[model samples]
Target: MDDHTALIRATLDHIHQGVCIFNKENRLVGWNQQVANMLSLKLTQFRVGADFDFLFRRLQDELRIQSGTSPASVLAWVEDRGPRPPLRFEVRQRQGRVFDIFAQEMPDRGFVISFTDVTAERRAAAALRAANDLLEARVEARTAEIAVALADAERANASKSRFVAAASHDLLQPLSAAKLYCASLADDTLAPAQTEILSKALNALNSVEDIIGALMDISQLETGNAPVRVGAVDLGRVLRQLGDELHPAARAKGLDLRIRPSHALVQTDASYLRRILQNLIGNAIRYTRTGRVLVGTRTDGDALRIEVWDTGPGIPLAEHENIYKEFHRIDPAANTGNGLGLGLAIVERACALLDHPHGMHTRLGRGTCFHLTVPRAGLPPRDAALPAPEPGTDLAGLIVLLVEADSQTRRALSGLMERWGVEVLDVASGTEAAALLAEIDLVPDAMLIDAPVDDGHAGLALIARLRAQFGQVPCRMLTADCTPGLGADCVLMDVSLLLEPVDPAALAFFLASARVSG
Candidate 1:
């Protein structure tokens, strides 16, 4: 062979793939040793004068026919003798070996074919497909498990909310009775030492009541049960009421409680807004030893910023984020107030429900200012403030109907009303109360019905019946249920709602007002 021909032959033999060449007459012109090895053919079979069709027939006999290709189809393709386009296909030998075959027609109407071992590539592809299927199956199983776990967690949370409500209702019944008994005793003349003991006892009871209330609030807010009624709320009136209520506690601590007057109307849930400010102002007054607690409102762009500023020991930087967590306290040793550390948690949740943004600013050793922004509504009505009943108002000569399920609470409350010179007709159920009133043929000046009276029917239903029977008498519904829609129901029925444990002062005010109106 010439130098160039020798070099070409050497290159073709060195290649990994089998190589073969054909001449115009369809006779073998060139060949590589790899072609013989890949096709399992003897080197002696590779003669220069060998026909391409004969070589292909020999290869077909040595290899298994591909799935969709028949011996007839192969014979037709070989006999056509026409120019063929480049073709590629995979085939397997009967001995379980895979090969890739390629054929390309030369310009002279002859064709060359090559073979390459592909057994390892096919095995690796199959293994990869199996691994992918396994991974997909595992992912699907895990996803199903997570879905079931999440459903279980949600059910547990709902159950927890129901349990808390039931337990609080049961607990508050006795607690209200205790508080009423204490109030009754306080009215009796006693020795100086006995009076002090009674005062401390009342304080202890009040602390317990506060803790229970905080727990109930936290439960409602956390479990998404606290109902929000957004409307135009008179901000000034709420602040004034809170100021009047908390003034005594502030004065007792020698702190100035300043509530700047504002007539701004805002869109929010009145009850929640009141509670948020109540907790913030109360917290300020509690933490502040001898400084002023200021509450006021200022106008932002389209919102009102209500702020509660206090001159007290500022919170540490590290404790800022933690203050909103349940039962988390800063300087617990120094906190002497009746707080369960749930105040801020309630504020945070309530604000989130209302979509109100609340934040705080503080400086160590100076004080802290907590503020919340609320969307402002139009001008408030001309008369926003209702006349508050005078403190220590008398309820004497008032015939009040008390429908309490618990006997202890009924007796205790009756004694308290009697001590206040009021006549109380106490019954354990709505049926008894109605029957007693009918027997006596007497119309009470006011009614105090425990919500969900002993028979498990709502007090509002009873109130409606009583009003229908005996003209619209001033009515109040005493309840331990803080569920949503209770307040709206009471409002629609024109009955006041006093949540248990009922404050003696609030109960007295309702009776005094009812007596006066009657």
Candidate 2:
């Protein structure tokens, strides 16, 4: 062979795929040893002048023509010189091996064919498909398990909420009775030691009541059972009300509770906003041993920032996030009161539900300030202020119709009201109260009814009936059931709501207002 031909043959021999060329006369012109090896042909049989038809026939007979074309048709297809795209196909040998074949027509009517061994590649692709299938199956099974577990957890949470509702109501009944009795006893003359003992007893009862209230609030917030009625709320009025309600407690602690007044109306759920601020201020008061707790508001670019500041041992940086967690105390040893540490938890959840952004700023020992941002809803009405009953106001000659199912609570409340110079017509049920009122033919100046009198329906019905009968008597509904919609119901019925165990100062203020209105 000449040098050029020898060089071309040497280059073809180095190629990984089998390479072969055929002329227009269908005779082989060039080929590599790989062509002979891939086709299972002897070197003598694969001569340079060999006919392409003979090699194709041999391959067809040996490999069983897996492409589903007969040898005659394939030979005819190869003999044709029509212009077309490159033909690519796969063939499997009888020995279970696979090969990829490529045939490209040259410009001179001849063709170049290549054979590539794809047996390992096919096996690997099959293995990969199987592995992917197995992985997808495992993922599907795990997803199903997670869905079931989530459903179970949701059911358990709902059950716990129901239990909390029932247990709180049951517990608060006697707690209210005990507090009322202690309050009544405080009015009587006693020695200094006896009075101190009585005060401590009342403090302990108050602690229990606070813990229960916190738990109930947390449960309502977590279970999404706290109703949110968003509207334009009088910020000044709410602040003033809270200040009036909490002022006594702060004074008792010897802490100055300063509430800065503002007539800015805010767009928010009034009930939730009130509860959130109540918890913040109450928490501040609880932790603060000395100094002052201040509540105020400021305008902040279409939003109102309501802040509660306290002069107590501030939260540590490490415990900042933990403060919102249930039952997590900053300094457990220093906390002497019976608190479950649920105040901030409730506040957090309530704020989240209201979509109001809340946060805190703190110093280690000086103090801490908790703030919430709410959207501004313009100014309140010019005459938004009503004269609030003054502190230490008396309810003497105020006839209060008290309808409570629990006998002890009824008796204790009656005694406490009587001590305050109010005439109390206390009864165990709405039926008894109505019957007693009918028999005496006397209209009470106000009505204080337990919300759960006959599964929370009778008390509401009794209020409606009495208002229809007596013409617009001021009514207050007391309840330990912190269920959703209770406040809305009270509002719709135009009655005040007092959550138990009721604060004595708040109850006294209500009675004093009733006396004034009467």
Candidate 3:
């Protein structure tokens, strides 16, 4: 029997599962090392005669069963649920190492049990299930947002397209008519009060032009049609030019236009850079009804820096980003020609296109300043000798024939021209001027006609008549409808061209240049 015992121990140790020998009365006659390990420990070491019932009583199952039972009964309970070929569980072992236990009915009488460390596999399965749940949740969230966002974008795009089409037709047509009428009224002889009223009308027309130009620029920028010419830009020169050009406009509104000297040059498209300053300056002048607008520049390491300051109704912190959204007007009924709300959008896009870094600083009710850092457009060596705009009397005794349909515009223009010392024969319209020419014998050296009426800012017929009869006269066309190649068109029509709402100085200089060119 001792030899049989040694043989049974050897066989059980070699077996992969737990082995135990019990009599017909259900007594633990012997157990192998595998059974002891699988069941936590040698129970006989504690109670000398401890049996399976003691360990079974401590077993806990997912079904919440609590009882001491034979291994065969436990196996029957698991298999009863279904055709379970295998049963798995954890056992309370003496060691802390967790093990998965499996039990099966042996061929003869007793049972064979097996156990292993399945902690890694169980954890991995749990992790996979968790990951799957997280992915499903994310997919659901994204699916919800996709529909609403796309619908909003599509609707917005359609509305914008319709607006652009309508503006192209409706606005430009009436604007053309108003310009012609203003030109004709300019020549009408009237009292100072009547003249002032006419001037107001012309001013209104000029405002219309500003609004139209702003809208057009915004639309073109959105459509990706605005021409971008990349070239060297001088920051100082542009700042100074804006300072001089806007100074009078700011002063007219009881504000100051100031510029701080810039030491660095910027490497960017000069035209694009100029447009940025134009928008910024335009914005500053619009909001700053009381205080001052200042354009300043400084050095930013290897980059050139620029800043625009305005002491007006400043922006709130939360609004800084929203203000850059296209066509996002802050004021529902903005009376001032501030913008169509696309000015800053254009500025932002321009900076991105130029690869410049930009930011803004503002305090509510105080003022705001926007700044940008642009790469230096490696400047060229300046010529040793450069001449400034020389002071000269190029307009003394200059003779000009001015034909305009708008009386107020004529008055304003006449004031500007007279200030330049040009002797202007201001007429109400091209027709009246033609009749006046037929009656009088005096021939002016030059004639400038505001080209458009309800028919066109520039009357093609009137220009043809002027060319046919007064071939020697240097005719100039002026209008508020500023477009690319406009000046070239006038050149082709055999006349000098000038933009309307003309600066007294610019008109004077243009005439001087025209005389020289002719």
Candidate 4:
């Protein structure tokens, strides 16, 4: 019997689960080393005759059950759930360990209990939950930050658009004044050298004007302000007009400039096509030192290829892509023009807006040719309506009432009109204009008014009042704003609107047209 008892103890000690047994008298009859270890008990303390309460008290202490709790209370709670059947539940200890506890009823009206550690599984699950919660918190924070950044970027873009518009309008006013004064200067007699000097100065001023105008165009394109108006465009007429306008510049440089007419009509925005060709041709004449600059067109399948050939130092293969970027210039010394290097950039944007495919072919030190494909109109070309010819010197006694708020613009325009033999009544305000009209005996032939005549104040009401007083006086409105609403307002007011910088010759032609209509 002693040897059998020794074998049973050895087998129980080797078992994975902690085991303990109680007799019918409720005294602990048997226990293994695993049971004592699990309950944090010494083998001597867990005597063979000790009561079941001793094991319960040991378990309660290890689990940190409230100090006021006694072994009898735990036993009573377990017993109140009814006679313990073969049941399983969990027990957790204060030392961060857990176990699955099982109870089995014995045939002799006693019970046996077992404990199995399950701490690793529970700890891993708890760690995963914590990590998931942290990830969700980070994602929410990042999304909120991106939303704020996007809103700030939108506001900054809006502010930049407004600033560009305002600055362009203001800058053109002084440029208009300068251009008018230059025209008046053209009528003065001077030495041959002086004449040449004056011509050079005018050219320089035109360059400055072009730079500002290009900047404005870029701003308009970026802000979606430039609306493309597509219609039947006569490539012949457009080519002819460009030839007439740009021939003198090319001739002055002793370069051969030729325009081959094409009667082909194309579907396009005439204005945008004109701008594209102008930039191409201007670059050709600007860069070429000695050779021909040819402008012509040909049919290629269903499209017309309008090409500009230049004898300038051709662009390299590497620079073909970069040349279209703003402020990118290959060689500044290749041309005498003080361009802002935005000509090709504008051409690129206009082509993109028109959906026209354009590209260039060049061979370094030889020559270059740039071309754009335009879809054929497939219809006859319409003759452009031409304005009446302005009198060369017969504008004498043409009474004109001018209202301009910019002093420089007023002075320059008034001087130019007087020089052209037109009687000018110029004023800086609507009130001064009213006083001038009261003093004059004869009614003026036409009224020329500048928009926003008083520093940032629109002249709409003043125009209405003048129209009411003059009774059907022919009025012309000059402004730098090309906004959509302004055009509608001009139409409703029954006034002719001219964009600035105002050309003296164009103004004369406009006045003649007004006279014929009136």
Candidate 5:
């Protein structure tokens, strides 16, 4: 060989990558030292002029190379490899090392093969996979912990709701009794000055009750305790009752409580609708000093628009958005008679819960109008032949069974019943009533049962016992606030319910109606 050829051979010996060349006659012509090291070939058998097949068989057997087949099969594959394009392949040795091999045909018709070690790349990929597995495990554990914390928070909120609900009744019982006593006292013969003083006291008592009741409702609604029940609601009946209840107060203020007659029924939660209208109308009455507060309705496409128009100090455009926020008022310093400013907040929440659209339109000092759009009920129109309840029913000489737990409530109720000339048997519990029933010769014509009595079941138990013995006597269940479940129980018992602080006149009317129905 020439000197240049010898120098090239020396350079190939010092190269890092394994390289081998075969002549056109398919004999091994040259190879670097790296080829022998990489394949673990015996240098004695890897001589120049060795047949390419011999060299290939020696490398394959020594390195335990895997070609997805046996050594004989690989030899056959190598024999069939004629003139072809360049090719690349990967292989793993028995010693757990990896390699990338490249083979190409030279321009002179000789073949060259080269190999590179890739074992480190494979090890790095393995470490990355282990890290990914650890990360996934930690994420799953954190998700489980968050779910447990969420459940704990929900349970705590429910417990708080129950405590508030029970406390509302206890708080209102005394207020209800005092209101009843005031009403009974107003009926007595007294001087004009004494009568006027008693009237102011009654007004003060009513304002206190209104504040307490509004707070309880707002608390229940905000805490997600009040369940939303959507159904067809008789807006006409609700408006009429609301107007009747608040008419006395409006007249006392010398403002007109005008409720236009409407036969429109709408799709909404009936109780929630009542509350919304109650707040709006109550605000109208409380704010308006001289003019009128009109509760009216009109049809707007497939919706019924119920509007409360009041001749009161109108809301400013800037304050309109802020009005629905909790404890917000247009005139903060003005004495608007015991308003905590939660009325419109309750209205806004009720609208959102029902998915109903609501807005207000007002002009400075002309009047303010608040309206809500309720979806028109799809049911057929109400039958015109349906009869209304007979009013002004007399209660003289009617025997009434009254079950009340509070001492003041019992005395106030007894006094009201006596004033109406109705015979009342007032007891603190169902057990006492049963014992009294055994002793009394006269049977009760109707029952007025106080709900959520001792153990939360006494009122219901008494009703069932009375029904079993008396056979469907007309009964009225009285409560501070009638919860949804208790309302369902009242329906099942086929009885009427009166929420406190109950109006004495309303109670007397209910008792008289019960006597007539019995």
Candidate 6:
């Protein structure tokens, strides 16, 4: 090597910045001895061709974006971007501390860039940045807290949102149970006046559920937890199912429901897709009293464009974008048993999860169209179709033990059982039911235990309790909570569950089905 080359290499080696020399072809030509030291490179075994991906990633994470960007690209632009600052980039290999990265073009043949371990300098800068970030974060958090505190005065409203979001699960648990109990009451056959009182109770329960669920949806979207499960789906089938489910509701509300299917397959989660359509159509039915809800689909290159159109009180053009925001309800006091204004927010979040593009087109008082384009779902899974539950036999001349807490509920439920022509023995508490089980020689054909459960979640301990007592006795939970993650628990315990305040018809059907399966 020439004298200048040797000097450059030696001088660059003593510098404190991570440096490398690259040729015009953007290949690493040479690097100073410091690069090896900082990267934990052993002098005896040095590699000159390795990429700078790690170096840049460390920089990016450290917020040394400018410093990090040059690892792959040449630093020639540093000339115009101002004097290259000694940037604090993290050394991923050692991960000891951040380091300052300094670089300059070579004066001679190729280039000679060296690195000096400036971990201390980096740490110092990072410490400062972290302190600032922490301070900023605290400020943000405090600001939110204040917003919640003064929510009535319009100040704490924002912070109240954050606080509510954090404590939602705890707040919603009891409310969910109460709702289930209310539904159970509604499911009971009573005089018309009594039923009217129960209907009011059901409506109140629904409102609480809507608010809690909406808040949870907002939190999930904001926190990026609502991940999309990409899979192959039949879009036509999804539309049809949505139509079947919502058409009646729409018609009941004097709204038209139309599903225009396109013969396109999607590689996305069918559940998420269905949720999207349901939210859209449900909103249409809620807002448009005498209009139409139309769902249409098309193909655009590699994307599947799904559209939800509604002839409702069309959104004001200026407010279209804002409607996707959290709690952006146009009719705040409609009280139509519709959910918290979380539908659009959830749709927005779902779109993000799917990496889909969503847009809104509205003609005030005319109609509104929401369009989202998603990449097609992949090929169908081999295990797409899970077999339905085996139909069980009729419980002819059989006795059933309705083991549950809540005295009034037990009586109402007993009446339901009596109506089914099955002998029913209702108890005030689960303990009473247990006592009966201990005394009775012939165990009831099946037990419908309104059993209290551990964890205070939606699931029941009844599944395990019954399975332990009488294997395959067909125990199902009559719970009100509608959360996921129950199927696994049911499978593990070999139990079946039906949501609470079970419809007598559906319940009877389930009982006969359980008998057949047994």
Give the best candidate by lDDT: 2
Q: Show the colliding residue pairs in model 4.
A: none
**lDDT of model 4 at position 332:** 82
Off by over 4 Å in 3: 1-200, 261-264, 332-335, 380-518
lDDT per residue (tens digit) for residues 118-187 in model 5: 7898779888898888888888888899889878877877776667667777777988898889899888
Model 1 segments more than 4 A misplaced: 1-5, 22-29, 45-85, 92-97, 220-274, 288-294, 310-319, 362-367, 377-383, 429-447, 453-457, 460-476, 484-497, 512-518
Backbone collisions counted per model? 0, 0, 28, 0, 0, 22
The candidate with the higher lDDT, 5 or 6, is 5
Q: After superposition, how far is residue 354 of candidate 3 from its true place, in Å?
A: 2.1
Q: After superposition, how far is residue 374 of candidate 3 from its true place, in Å?
A: 1.6
Report the lDDT of model 4 for residue 276. Answer: 87
Could you estimate the TM-score for every candidate? 0.81, 0.82, 0.47, 0.59, 0.72, 0.46
TM-score of 4: 0.59
Clashing pairs in 2: none
Off by over 4 Å in 5: 1-131, 185-208, 380-401, 420-422, 425-447, 453-476, 482-497, 505-518
Task: Name the TM-score of candidate 6.
Answer: 0.46
Mind giving the per-residue lDDT tens digits that candidate 2 earns over 301-402?
999999999999999899999999999888878875669888899889988998999999999899999999999996664744446566677778888999
lDDT value for model 3: 0.62
Candidate 1 residue 12 Cα shift, in angstroms, is 1.7
Worst 10 residues of 1 by lDDT: 484-493
Q: Write the per-residue lDDT of candidate 1 for residues 1-518, one digit (tens) a residue.
A: 59999998999999999988877677899989998888788999999989877877787767875557666765565556766657666789977788887777777776777888988998899799999999999999999999999888778877887788788888888899888998888888999999999889878877887788788788878777466788777777677556655766676688988888778888988777877887999899889998799988888999999999999999899999999999989888899676799999999998999999999999999999999999999986475444445556677788999988778888888998898899989998879988999899999998898886233237888888999999999877788776545654554355656768777876776776676566
Provide the overall lDDT of each model, using Cα atoms, as 2-decimal numbers.
0.81, 0.82, 0.62, 0.76, 0.76, 0.59
Q: Please report the TM-score between candidate 5 and the true structure.
A: 0.72
